[model samples]
Every structure is written in C-alpha cells, then in structure tokens.
Target: MFTRKQFVSASVGALVAGTLGACSSNGSNGGSAATKASDDSYTLVQSGKILGASDLQYPPLSQMNESTGQPEGFEIDLLAALAEKMGLESGWIDPIKFDAIIPLIQQGGKADVGLSAFTITDERLKQVDFTDSYLDSNQGLVVKKELTDDAEAYLNQAGRKVAAQSGTTGESWAKENLPNAELVPLDDAIQAMTGVSTGLYDGCVADLPVVSNLTLNSYTDLTVAKQIPTGEQYGIAVSKDNPGLTKALNKALTEIQGDGTLDELKTKWFGSNI
Candidate 1:
C-alpha cells in the first residue's frame, strides 16, 4: 500500500526511531539528565560526569543479576574506579542497543565514553577514537557440543545458520568470513545465546567473555568451537575530537590497570585475568 519513495522514507524513519529509542539519555531526552555538560566548565573536566553505556546484560562486563536483579560486572566496576580516579561523578545511562552506542556518540554526542565490551578494530577506529585496550577478547565460535566437530572440520558451511548481535564485531566477522552461512543478527547477547540453544541457529559468534559466560551459566549445551586470536581487544570509546576526555580516560585506565583493580575484577568474574 506504499509507494516506492514513501516506503524508503518510512524505512529511514524506522531506523531513526529505533536509534533514538536505543540512545535516549533520559525521558524523551528531557530534564537535567538530558542536558549536555557545558564546555566552559573545567569542573566538566575534573568533576564532570558524562553519560556512559547502553544496558547491563553482558555478563562479566555488565549484567543484571538474576537473583538480586542488581547490575554488577567488570566494566561497571572499572567505570566506578575510573570515575573516582578522574574526580568525576559517573552517571548511569539506560538501555541503548549495542550498535546504537557508537552512532549516538558519533552523530549525537549522546555518551561521553562507551564501554560495552566494545572491540577495538581498524574499521571502528575510523568512526571514533578508542581508549587503550582494557579487555582482550578474540573472535570465538560457540556451537552445540555435538556440532562442535562439524564447525572445526568446516570453518564455513553453506546453508547453515550463524547468529550474532547486531552492530557488534561478531556480526561483522560472521558476515565477512562466513559468507556461505546464513547470518542472523539479534539485538543482544541474550538473544544470540538463546538462538543457539533453541536450534534456531547452528552457531553463534561472539567475544571470548560472552562465550565463557554463556557456556558456564546459561548455555550448557554450547561450547567454544574455535577462537580467532589475531590479537583483538576491546576498548572504551569517545568522539574522535574529544582528546581531553580521551586523555583523562587513558590516565584513569592506566591507574586501574597498574593498581590491579582491573585484574581483581577480572578474576572475580572470569576466574582468571584476561
């Protein structure tokens, strides 16, 4: 019932709407919560807190506890330490989709720094500058224990289905490398894990932390089939021009890594320092 031009407009509108829904800082982007910090304020440098992160559901990094429903994870702990070291008050932002986080920062300046287990890559670097590597995670494949051998035998299987969260490095890697496989992009880690468990997908591609977390706690049926360890790592991200913020973040990050807070949190969550 829609004309070609009208359909195109509608599709574009939908994408925008979806992005806004994911990145809205506060209610309808209103109130004190929605306002951006003033550049003239040095307090914005030392004492300023900028919005960060999307949702807290990626385990070991950020996740809401199933028992207590409280949010706790490695990234949250690291952010807390960084905030204290930087003399800034950390403001928590709500549930933005993973892919929307970078776009919001680039186009809208939505968050000051994004730390959602984001992988650092050459392709992503063109869009935004990244903090030094805070977490190292290789591209990994998770498959049913029974089908693990199949994936090991044939790295790419035509007519088979692979799943990953939209806008993530996993999705990009799968699309690029697994060209023969049907790729399904879900919105979050939970969905990707569930898809494999439900037999809706033959395998799921994700970061190592995601593979470990799901295999240990949620998806017992799944196991890591292969790991692409070309030395990929995750980093905190900010707008390219915001060198001041990046510098401050790097200082705080260095302190955390030096004082062993990062490793302490890593061991607590992951059972080993990654």
Candidate 2:
C-alpha cells in the first residue's frame, strides 16, 4: 500500500534487516497470555494472543520488569492496548538479539510482531512489513552532568569517545555528525549509556525517549545534552506473510492515537509527550 515511503536499500533497512522484526517475532518460540484472542481477521503466532520479539533491555520503551520478569514499557502497554482493540490479549515477549529480530520474523515460528523501538525505513521494508508509524523519534545525546559545553560541538572533535548502539540510527547519526570523534558502537542503546556512566566513554547517542527516561530517573548523574531531530518514526514490524495483521494493527493504532492513549503513555513514561 505504502509503496514510496522508507528502508531496505540504503543504510537503514539493510542495516536493520538485521535489526527489526524479521518474522521471528514468529520465528520459533511460543509464549502467549492465558486468554486467547478470538479475532479471526488475521493469523497469529499464538491463537489467542499477539506474541512479540524484543531485545528486552531498553527501558521505558520495552524492557523486562525486574519484579515480574516479563516485558513492560510504552511499547508493551501500547501492544496490549492495540491487541485489546483487535479483540485479542497481549502475548509475552520473547527475548531475542537486537540484530536478529527481522530474520526471526522471516523464519515464521516465534512471535507475531517485533515490539522493539524499530524505526521503520524503506531498507527494513524490503524484509518485513511494518504497521503504520506509531511514535516520532530522534537521536539523543547522553553525557555526564558535569561536562556541559555545547553538547554537539564538544563531542564533535577527535579523541572524544562516544558510545552508540550498533545497527541503530544513533550510530549513523554519530558517524555523520561527530565525524572526528571516536565512536564506540555497543550492543544496545542502554549499554552505550552504561558505558558512559562507568566513565568508559564521554557520551552516548541513542533514541530520545529512552535516554530521556534514563537520565531523568535511574541514571540521575547523566543528562540529555541534546535531542537530534532525525525525523524518524517507530513502527511495528509484522511479517510480509501477514498483511492482514498489519492492517489490523494500523486500525488499532489509529484508534489509540485518536483517543489520546498514545499521548498519555508518552507523558506517563517519558515525563511528557515527546
């Protein structure tokens, strides 16, 4: 339907085919809620639920609840709300590697959708279909609270060690903007922030909502020095084999967006709508 929009050929999709939902969200796992959704419009990984694939470490977006040992965050809550709209229950999140989500979706036995903070692009479109864009996103700079010069300028020089999550747009942004800096690509965005907190790096680049949540709460010593507007939007990665699911999800997403559920979630988790 949306033929001329975003990823697969350039840096984003190709870089993220290894990144978003491949189908493995439906790849080879089985974890669903107790009550099965009775919807019959689309096929699902689990009969009554919408199973998901995730990295499970990024907080406020999607992460494992320390006490519950299950996934929680804006994405998780949004997923439940969307599933309910579709007459289904929210399924459990299967912990998958960051770069392996899309491939797993392609494999067809794991989960129903990939629930990570996936920035939909034409490159990723070549691999898996995406539902309508849910959240507008941008790159963020996380730095130690003590060093507060022009955030971008101070870090745009040689010898400034900056950490970025590998295979994410944040890495690409750092490469293009902080050309002279020593960019360290970590396994995930949170790791990049942790590396900075431990004094291993001067700063880190990652998604805005994620870094914003961390700096405001858990990592109090850190601060969001800058928010780089990348004009990126996050989407749910569904299987190409499951177009029905995509449409169904889009409908539900529209409902939430119209009803202000999305805005409320943003305010609850990120301290304000971003």
Candidate 3:
C-alpha cells in the first residue's frame, strides 16, 4: 500500500507530465479573433458574464464557503469588484486546480480570467499575461513546533523532507535553496501544511500570507519558521491572446487602488499583518 506521501508525489509527477503535453498541444490559441478586439469593444467569453477560474482551497486568498457552497475570499471579492466595474454580470466562477487554471486560460473560451493567488513571474508571463499586481508576497516556511526556530537548519540537511505546491515559486525555491533535502510536491498549500503537521514532511514552503493565515487560524501546531523574501507579487491572470481583457482589468485595478477599495479589502482579509 502506498503511503499518502508516495501517492501525492506520484500524482504531482503525473500532473507535470500531463501539463507538458497539454501545453504543447494548446500553445496559445489566442482565442477567436473576437477575443482580440480593443478594450472598449471586447465581449465577454459568455454574454453578460465574467467567467473566472480558480483553485479556492487556500483561505483568506481564495476558499469555498461550505455553508453557502459559494466562493469567498479576498481574491474572490476583488474579482467581483473588477467584474462589476467592467460592467459584466457576476458570472460563473469555476473552481479548478491551481496548476490547470493557466492552461485553461491559454486554451480560452472556458474562462475569461483567473484570480487565484497567482504570483506573476516571467515564466508564467510567457504562457499568459497578468494585470498589475495587487499584492506583494514572499515565500514562507511552516514546520511543527518542535522544529520552529531551527526549521531552516533542519531543512538544509540531507534526508529532510520539505513540501511545496507543485508548479509554484515555493517549489522552485525549495529546489534551488534546499538541494540536499528531499522535495515533496503536493497539490496545494493546505495539503503541504497538513503534511508538516502530521510529520509527513519536516516543513512546508508556501506564500507568506497563506502560511501565516493557516498557522494562526487552523493549524496551531504549526509555526512560520522563516519568511524567504522573494519579493513576489500576485496578479490576475488573463490569456495572452486577450490583451483587451488585460487592459480592462488593469483599469479596474487602478480605480480600486486609487479609491481605497483595495486597501479596505486587504485590511478586511489580511489585517495589518499583511
């Protein structure tokens, strides 16, 4: 029987293989010519709806409300504001796997945008465009209380297992920085932290806000050992083919920022700690 750790590792490996194949075939459709129109003339993927795709498992950023079965998070609220400002109806916000959302955007027609806690990077920019960043972030480590202060030291040693979400900057950071440690790739931040709490992993690497939020709210046994200052920034992802949508989102973002709506949302969700 495979342990949970083995199963997760195998699953991520398969996902990476599938993602590579999908990317090769999709290769930026640029969508229909209709999607390439000017910002003022562009139409929604679906009439009267601003379709969004996200993995809503990360709390404070994006999570599902179990009682209402509706998506609710800082990113969700921000997207709602953007959709309203763009004069589109509150359309379908589909829940999707984090790594798959970019591919869906690249393929087009399925979603108009992606608003998970997507950190904008040059590599990601090659596949899809991003609106102006709304949040600055850093990579953080979460470990069991026993390893709290010495988590970094332990992670630096060989045979230590450190987990991170596959395809995220946190994973890349772990690979680059902890070359001697065994890198465990999980599906999301929540799972990575859970693994740490259960002693499946020595530590979990994820966004600073996410690790902090989870540690404070849900996983009291976990502590943020170190915050790696990567100076990351989260942005709303749009298809490379849909420059018009990108422009419109940027406009809405600027308005929210200028009118203090952005700050208010940040305070409401992240508090002064962020």
Q: Pick the candidate with the highest TM-score.
A: 3
Better of 1 and 3 by lDDT: 3
Q: What is the lDDT ranking, best to worst?
A: 3, 2, 1
Q: Residue-wise lDDT of candidate 2 within 1-274, one digit each (tens)?
A: 1111111123246335675332212212443222212221345666557888889778899888889887888888999999877767887655877778988876666788887889998888899999888889888898999876688888888889999877788998999999999999777877888888999999999998888888887889999988898999999999786676788889889989999998998887787887
List the global CA lDDT of all models: 0.72, 0.78, 0.78
lDDT (Cα, tens digit) per residue for candidate 3, span 25-49 = 1112233333211233343466555
Q: How accurate is candidate 1 locally (lDDT)?
A: 0.72
Model 1, 220-258: lDDT tens per residue? 988888886747788887876565467667788898889
Per-prediction tally of clashes: 0, 33, 0
On the 0 to 100 scale, the lDDT of residue 2 in model 3 is: 24
TM, every model:
0.79, 0.82, 0.85
lDDT of 3 at 224: 91
Candidate 1 lDDT for residue 192: 81
